[model samples]
Target: MNSGILPAAVAGFSTGLSLIVAIGAQNAFVLRQGARRHAVLAVVGICAASDAVLIALGVAGLGAVVTAWPAALTVVGLAGGAFLTCYGVLAARRALRPAAAAGLTTQGTSAGSVRTAVLTCLALTWLNPHVYLDTVLLLGSVAADRGSLRWAFGLGAMLASLTWFTGLGYGARLLGGVLARPAAWRVLDSLVAATMLAMGIMLLARTF
Candidate 1:
């Protein structure tokens, strides 16, 4: 019995990690907050906890209900796409201004405020349609057939979320020195802008 459960748990861990390791809005926000060393704990906690809740719901069979209501994901996709496009534009604007990027890296700004950080983290997590597809529909669908070991699969997935968020939020500082430079900041922001823009376009395009 334990042997059968172990494979499912491992599969859950790998799947959960794979789904989240991509460069997405939530990750970009978390990395920025982590690099800024501002409200890192709050950002990481929110991300991990949100993932855990989503995974649990998925494992508990919420995925079927969500899949039944495609309209819900459409709404989320529309909102999330708009938000990502706006954020991408802001990032692009910042990248164009070397001084602004440099200042943001050094002096910081109101965007780093705890309230703003937490709110942004929440929005990034909850508003994204992909999160629903991956966490609820995909993971839930897979876990539903795990028989008695379904919860074990969920527990493993939840652990993966916690580990990934903790590492990302805390480990971001390793690149602090590189991002401190204006040129490097430009590169980072440019990548972030492109990523956000592409993702937003993809989401919006899919809806049409």
Candidate 2:
């Protein structure tokens, strides 16, 4: 690796870590799947693969298109915010519903199959505008300034995604049994709702 590549890699890793560390919809979904021990690998695989593709595209100059099209970002941000808010409300409702919450368990299929998990993971990763902004626009712009270090930076970002999703998908499983409790489920639901709402509000606030 070139001398400049080290800084680029570090920057990329930091960017990727910051974006993935947040408790977004995708991360929540991944954790839920992990808790269920259902299609965890597939979900992580989809997330990592999607990140790789997006990071590659960004590093290859697609960030310019995103930068030029401010309207696109606005539209995407609005859509993402709406989705997050709606999802958050649903989660909060579940949290508040005593009867319905009682039957909730940490283990189950969200869509009945690994294929569905893969598709859902892909949507969660790709459909969110924030993902594009973080991985493609921000990381790409920074990587672009690195000349020959761009590829290394992209690789580091990809690795960061892989590490996070993998850890989320597998690590959360350890708490599955405990989270399977009704009260625990309610708490988790509440947490997820709060996280989603916060992220949605933050995104909307940034847009205007």
The sequence of per-residue lDDT tens digits that candidate 2 reaches over residues 1-36 is: 467777778778877788788777899888877876
Model 2 ranges with Cα > 4 A deviation:
1-11, 106-119, 201-208
Q: For residues 1-208, write the lDDT of model 1, one tens digit per residue.
A: 6888788888789889988998888888788778777789999999999999999999998988888999989999998888888889998998899988888655544555778889878888888898888998899988888988898899889989999999999998899888878988788788889988998888899877
- Candidate 1 lDDT for residue 150: 90
Native-structure RMSD, model 2:
2.8
Candidate 1 local Cα displacement, residue 206, angstroms: 1.6
Q: Global lDDT of each model?
A: 0.87, 0.81
Cα lDDT for residue 36, model 1?
A: 72
Candidate 2: global Cα-lDDT?
0.81
The segments of candidate 1 whose C-alpha lies over 4 angstroms from its true place after superposition are 1-3, 108-112
Pairs that collide, model 2? none
